[model samples]
Target: MDIEKIAKAIEMDAGERLPDIRESLQEMVDGKAASVHTPEQLMLRTTRQKLGLSQSDFARLIRTPVTTLCDWEQGRFNPPGSLMCLVEIADKRPDVLRDVLM
Candidate 1:
């Protein structure tokens, strides 16, 4: 085939020949799901370290147990489905979320 014709064919068939983009999009979706954390979780996790609050204190502020927040941070398991929804909603309006949560 002529070089120009081959180039056109490659361009047209690239998605079929290269499925990596589909996988990349899926990975982004998964990361978004995994990265989410509740406003209370985010606020406590981000600030308590600076304030020198013990995990126990931070847990009380966030109304959760030390073990649960520890597990959330460590990726042992995610917050509950309802908390995920709050996280995602907060993420969409980060400025407002940060101000209110902080």
Candidate 2:
């Protein structure tokens, strides 16, 4: 295999794509680009935010490990249906959840 040739070609390709990459990043920063989030992720994050809690606090309040909560929020894992139902309730009635659960 011609490793050196392959490396050089990759470098050239990256250089050629740099401008487009920068433009895409700029668009994201300018809010011209939209990023997709799954419904579960959105709901979990929204619930936590609505309760005005940080990840660790929210995780503790929900009795889940912070890492697991992070996984759910980042869409790396799907929270169970029961957890989703709780999250929906929390999202809709943050005050109630906080009052009852906290």
lDDT of each: 0.58, 0.81
Runs of candidate 2 with Cα error greater than 4 angstroms are: 1-36
Which residue segments of model 1 deviate by more than 4 Å? 1-44, 80-102
User: Quick one: best lDDT, which candidate?
Assistant: 2
lDDT of 1 by residue, 19-102 (tens): 354554556556654365655556535555654567786566456888987886555676687655544554456555447655
> How badly does each model clash, as a count of residue pairs?
0, 0
Which 10-residue window in model 2 sums to the lowest lDDT?
A: 16-25
In candidate 1, position 6 carries an lDDT of 49
Candidate 2's TM-score reads 0.63
